[model samples]
Target: MNRERLFSQLVSHSGPFDIAIIGGGATGLGAAVDAASRGHSVVLIEQSDFAKGTSSRSTKLVHGGVRYLKQGNISLVLEALRERGLLCKNAPHLVHSLPFVIPSYHWWEGPFYGIGLKVYDTLAGQLGLEPSRYLSREEMMELLPTLETEGLDGGVVYHDGQFDDARLAIHLARTAVNNGAITLNHTRCTGLMKEKGHVIGVKAECVETGRQHEIRARCVINATGVFVDDVRRMDDAKTENIVAPSQGVHLVLPREFLPGESAIMIPKTDDGRVLFAVPWHGRVIIGTTDTPVEHASIEPRALPDEIEFLMTHAARYLTRDPRPCDVLSVFAGLRPLVAAKNAESTAALSRDHTILVSDSGLITITGGKWTTYRRMAEDVIDHAEMIGGIGVKHCVTHDLKIHGSATVLPKDDPLAVYGSDATEIRELTAKEPEWARKVHPKLDLTCAEVVFHTRHEMARTVGDVLARRSRSLLFDAQASMNAAPRVAAIMARELNWDAETIDHQVNRFQKLASGYILEG
Candidate 1:
């Protein structure tokens, strides 16, 4: 993933591409990987770093939607369940099975939910993980030591997939690049290039450098997550908005709050939503409240009420209540849900993806979750072939190995999340002992990981390195702030940042990270 070489290719390409994708998040990158692996000439551009928006800010679960099953959207649940299984198979290093316990307080709650989970397991069929089983009160407590137990009857445990969302996104981008797709971060799509009112290409500008390029494509796919409508309007000004943005917020807490391998799942909350407290990267992440938002943002903030809502629920479930002061970090992501006519609540809207070909032949794909990204890519590219008149190539991403894909990893090694690439990083640490130094006292991140991401993973800014590449900012905001100077220094040495650039990057990251901390 050499940005300089890719950028030169973007500038010097003589002919129009078979596919030009806008928005380098999950959908776009998936499309790039799917299309390119099928021998299509593909190019993708993102305004910011990959997964900077909703893709990175996820609940970190790769599972069939249990809530959707209760709502009777059986098709969605079935599709997501298949995709979830495939993701675990394809990216075993990043995605794995995680146990979830649903504590039951009432007599009837056990049978009711237990039957529902049985159906869930049935839907997954051969691809399912361990089956759901009933647990006695003693058994449940052993799994979740901190669960509140005043009227606890028993519990049911089920299996789902868990992963690092941003890390997977980076892998997806790398897989696309490995398959010969040019993916550029910090490249903004300014406008659509139209001939005779037919969408042909895009006018993009380099955000780092002011250089611009007119990239013509036979097919232009808009996979821009929450900001899909923004790109659609470039084709037609009067394009009625199709996306109804919904915000989901999560809070990161210490592992002591959930000091176990299994996670806690609240089947039903006061607002008819589900809440989860899952463990990731040595931290406990409890989320998420789904609230409707008018517009999408690059950096979404957790609402005061949303924070309070989570705190109230956390107190209800945990024996030890977590207060605002206990919060380590908080983040928010907006869903690009396709709007339903007369849809009163965003929660009722569809999680299934929608692909629309506009009057000008612009192919737009929106309204999907992270789990079904590969399927969405497959569908949109099939549509592109029919609409854009590109040569047909069947989808090959189902069995394609993501970059750094590995089956087994050492459990004690903190760099295991890097998959096979961890060995190279370990060699770097062995060669240069300074690279192995911890970035912060509280975090497992090392300076070697920062240098590696900047050199190979298209990491450009301190935010890109801390927020996405290493997930330091999401893990602990204050610690990430304290470690910013060290990270900027390492990136400076690797990417040749001057003293002024180092100061600017560190200051900018501190200001951004401060918002993730709840004021005591």
Candidate 2:
């Protein structure tokens, strides 16, 4: 996970490559691993740090798209569920099942959802994930004691996998590197190189050193999430714009807001969107309003209107009304839905991915969720090999074991921690109290986890360490702001950065972290 070693590998492999992947998000990283594991020399370049885009801005769920099932996209749902199972098996440390409670208000609501959940369970029968169960009102009350019991009839509990999406991307990148793939972050692809109207390579600039380089390859794949269209337009002016950005936002509050082990899923809302109050990283995470966005940018700031929208809906089930001040942090992400000619609402747009081979021979892949990243990578690589005249190899990612997969705690172990509850902190503190005291003297995050971020997680900045690696920024942006100086010092000592560099990183992190906090 040494940044220098990774950069050295990329600089060493400047010759012609079997595959050159543009964009270092989940799909691109997955493709790199898939292709490189098959013995193909691979090079992956990103405009910013890895997983600095939508891949890190997800709801952090690896479940089958239940909404897709409602839309009767059975094939997509089944495919995603199967992939979720594979990810759970292959990366158990990063992907684990979380129980979700779907509250029912109407008399027939319970049976209606129960039947659908039964169908969902049937699809995932052999996948080894826990099946759905019906919870009586009393059981529901016991599970979610804070829920308002005014109109509750019963509930249906189902199991779905949850994960740290950015960490998963990091692990995929590490796995690719371990298998001989050269992956470089902070590397931007400026232009596509062509010979006789065919894309033969790419022109790139290193953001860190401002150095220019050209990577020659037989095939170039564009897996940039919302930015795929930009790369496509570079290849062919006539190429249609295929990405419509959809904005989704999440709010973080204290765990005392809904002290529970199970997540609450609000199925139907007046605004035609589903709401979820899930426990994550020792705090409660309530989210996600789907709004349309025209521009695609990292560190998307959540709007006040969107914040109010979520609070209005979430207040229905909570014991106390959650005010704007209760929100510890907020985040927004733009979804790259493949743009249809007359697309209306981004939510109605397709979640499925589209891979296009342009006239200039650039393969652009976009429009998929975190759960289906593996499948998206397979499809993109399959098309890349076909167009580049390179032989395709069978994907080994299904049975492939990611980092920490072998060391993941067993499911039946009594000491196993579930969800992002305080159990994780307690376990870490019990094992490494000195580390815990250094990172989070007030909270539960440990110094060991911070060290682990630099040693194994490739965390280069305070924002990267707290925001993505440790979930501190996601849960409590203010706490992360307070911890930034200390984290910067630790990173400086470990990464060999000087005082000036540490101060620069701290200022940058503050600017980024401040955007997530609501100001009067």
Candidate 3:
């Protein structure tokens, strides 16, 4: 349904809800889905589009933190590993088994990561994807033909899971709706509502229409990710900050850069953190520097140092280094790390999530890895049930397949993106063949997909079309900019925009797309 209808429907609700989640990112979306699955009345809202924040800007791995395993946090590793398995089982279309190769420059490196990976595998028990094994230089060379093999002795192969993070968020939201949860994006929780000194609801604003509403819920969940502190203070003005925001950056390159099924895992970087070079959506995805930031921001950019950090490190390992000019798109995300006792470095903090109840009864869940989001949700909703005194129930997400997901996806390009729902696109193509044609020559995306997103996925603007719905903006920034007019035209028709609105959308998309292109 369109957002206008969503607002009217929510405004029409006269009774209190069993649960009201205040963010549409991973944890919040998961909570909505879980709470609804247990038969609780649910309503969720996001200030921006779904997955517009840190949720969409992930490393795209649903892995058990191999780094956590090194830190001797076996329990967390075990938990993430099991969740990784369940995600693959439930949403096989979005999440799947991926092989990772840790290439060794020194002789000891292979055996070192291999042994650790063996322990990682053992922890998974029956849920493990594949056993970690030592690969000869020949085997490693065969898998990753582009690696610089001068000092490479051998490598280790292990199994992990990778997924489309933003798409998964959308699926979770849809699944939640399927299970009777009402949702809206572009809706912000401006304040918390209290009665007798306990939070009873929230004061939310429709960001688009400038309309205000009081959403009275029996329980309010603060799943605002790195922005949890902002929501927490709404309940108590004097509370200390609870989240230590950690920024991470990633660069997207053409898939030819990796040209391998197995991803490259640099177990350690110059800064004592792990980085990944993974293949995602026909592109090579390289990332991640963990540096603590003083504040959380909605529009976080990759610092120049972070860009250098990723390129310098990644270039060292590849046969042909990916220069800034070679980068197709660069995006940054913040990790919501729980504030620790005199934590010196965000990299030193735990990736595990935290759930806290303020004195005013605002339930806040924050600080976790994307790999363990479902578990994080289950924990939050368990507490949600406890705090709200709602009936206790089990989390069915362990085996719950996401919406539009399938047992098998199409083997071809574009259509494969829709997973089991690819047939729907095929139907759209049948009606108007031009909808199936690419907006421009370089991209493989079809116009029909844009129609599908607006008609079904609640995409209302050019940014939603490029950034989230189709990921055109994420894969290739300049190309998305080049295709903006055509995309805006399609959106203008679907959204019924006037000339000024269409121009605004095209200009806004262009400005945003430029950020993804690194400056020389």
TM for candidate 3 is 0.98
lDDT, candidate 2, 236-278, per-residue tens: 8677777888899998888888887789888767767778898
Residue-level lDDT tens digits of model 3 in 211-243: 898998989999999999998888888989988
Please estimate how well model 1 matches the true structure, expressed as its whole-model Cα lDDT.
0.92
Residue-level lDDT of model 1, residues 1-520, one tens digit each, is 8899999888788899999999988899999999999999899999999999999999999999899999999999999999999999999889999999999999998899999999999999988999999999999889999999999999899999998899999999999999989999999999999999899899999997889899999999999998989998898888899999999999999999998899999999998899999988888999999899998899999999999999999999999999888899999999999999999899889888999999889999999889999999999999998888988888998999888886458545688778988887888898899889999999888888887898889999999988999899988999999999999999898888899999999999999999999997
Instruction: Flag regions of model 2 displaced more than 4 Å.
Output: 410-436
Candidate 1 runs further than 4 Å off: none
Assess each prediction's global lDDT (C-alpha) against the native. 0.92, 0.82, 0.87
Residue 135 in model 2: lDDT: 89
| TM per candidate | 0.99, 0.93, 0.98
* Colliding pairs, model 3: 435-448
